[model samples]
Target: MMNPESLRTVSVMRYILPLREGGSLPALAEADDDFKYVLKFRGAGHGVKALIAELLGGEIARFLGLPVPELVFATLDEAFGRTEADEEIQDLLQFSQGLNLGLHYLSGAITYDAAVNDCEATLASKIVWLDAFITNVDRTFRNTNLLVWHKELWLIDHGAAFYFHHSWNNWENSAKTPFALIKDHVLLAKASKLDEVHSEFTQKLNPDVLRKIVNLIPEEWLQWEDGSLKPDEIKEVYFQFLSTRLTNAELFLKQAQDARKTLI
Candidate 1:
């Protein structure tokens, strides 16, 4: 695993690319590599908590063994002196303009739907639920936040996570929020196949790794009316949700194993 601390040394340029309709990641080309990596610029004036959340979230996602892309934390340097009037508007694009490397935009040899749905049912379910439990704000149908690499689904774009801790701890009025309407969405229904797949793995989460992740967050990152949340709370909540998911997953798997029932 790449050390999370190394992200601070990534040399990012200031050239802004056009913002996609859905995500905050600025399009960026990795230095000297033919391939491009999506660059997410930290808001010019973000707090330590937000920064911590961004870094730790990526680290934890990888440690959890999810199909995430390799994350690199980079910075704006002199080669990045060029900027549009809105410095923050797509400021990460210049890094990708064939700097000896050709134009390599986001593309896959295959499409996301090509991944064998039945075979990856568990993987699909865990990632989606992890996002929901984390209250990740991206990954909607329009943005999906996934990439097809080696004919497998690889996750990308995490700048929108931890939105819950920042914006919704006391959000009792979930009905008023956009999330309330998704309870019975088709996506959720389809997720059942994944739920069944995931049930087997919930109890398998590496507790030691999870403990390290929760503790690694600089206490300031967790926010609530009273202040930041205790690390135990975060772990506990995650554990409970994942455990429930495991139970549900087992039932689904049992049904799938039985020839009479089809995988959802």
Candidate 2:
């Protein structure tokens, strides 16, 4: 398990360029640590909740022993936003002045193509299981979100995962909801070990690990507009949601297995 306290914090040295492909409008920025990262601004169109989902989902990927790019907290200075002439980008940067999420840029990485590349059954199964567990609906073949770096597959762009939290009203019931989107998962056909992976991950991702993952969210991101729940209470909500999902894993596990059988 990754130590939540060990997450590195780096200051933005320069705003390199904008990656306009994403809805959040993430940018490639050079950080104080002399490393270049794809910065996901908190004030982007999707809002801070998207960042929270990314952190929680990405950490889960790491915990499951999947290959994910290193995530860091990139500190952005107000001055960085001022240098941009684009009004929209400037506004986003200005709003995201304090802290944002950064994904380490993988040089020479190519987008994953299922047609040409062969994924190991175990790795593919693990990813399928993780996406199913987190309710991530973005990893379909059209937008694999998987990358090939150093001859290894790496997961990225997890902002769309855990979407249930966007509207927390029915979160408890949502946890037990069946993940129907598993049918379109990029690795569905390749996930031959779904049963074994499901059993192992269920046993490994205990409450302790889930709590540690939820604790990783910065307090500022937990602020609710209604102000009904305190930060600690909000964290507990997340823990409960995930715990509920784990306890009700059979529904999703069966869904994935059924999807795999159809594909094979």
Candidate 3:
């Protein structure tokens, strides 16, 4: 279980450079703690909702013993990024003032290459299960969103998970989805232990555990584009979506099992 107090908020000190790998244009930045971080701007494409998913997904993965970079609430000041040369980057920083999401930067980390690296069945299964539960659609071979640092696999860029929030309609029903996207998971071929990990992961993620992770979302990040729901209500929806999905894990587990069968 993640302690509510474990997530810290740090102020962004400097904009180091833009990581152009993804459309969101997340940047490498330095924080007040004097450590480098990969900063996800709230002003980016998906906006705060993406940040919300990052917090929920990353924390939930950590709760399940997955190796994720340390997550923090990074605040951007208005005066920062004034000297940037790029017009696109300058606009991104200008609109991205206020709270954002940051992942502790792992120096000398290389992207996970399934073709070259070997992953045990157990770890692969756990990762597939995590992506399935969150309805992540970005972990396909084309964009693995995984990093290997010091020979340890570290999960990153969870902003693409929990995609149901992109449209708030029928969120409860969304929880019942089988998340067919699991078919494209980079680790699907090696995830032979999905069933075993599903049972163990479900047990570890009780209602209390889910609530603690959901509660980590900052109120500022809860602004709905439709303006129909308040912050607390929005949080409740996320909690309900996750909890209901947990109760219906079989739906996605079956989908994953069937997908793996085709791959193997």
Which residue segments of model 2 deviate by more than 4 Å? 1-5
Off-target runs (Cα >4 Å) in candidate 3 are 1-4
Best by TM-score: 3
lDDT of 2 by residue, 10-58 (tens): 9999988897665688999899889999999899877888898888989
What's the CA error at residue 203 for candidate 3, in Å?
A: 0.6
For all predicted structures, in order, the TM-scores are 0.56, 0.96, 0.97
Q: List model 1 lDDT by residue over 119-205, tens digit each.
A: 254565556555544445666555566667676766665555555444535433321233322232213434545444354445454
* Candidate ordering by TM-score (highest first): 3, 2, 1
Residue lDDT tens for model 3, 126-200: 999999999989888898999999998989989888898887789989999999889999999999998899989
Each candidate's lDDT (Cα)?
A: 0.45, 0.88, 0.90
What is the Å distance of residue 240 in model 3 from its true position? Answer: 0.4
Of the two candidates 1 and 2, the one with more favorable lDDT, higher being better, is 2
lDDT of 2 at 51: 91
Q: How many steric overlaps does candidate 3 have?
A: 0
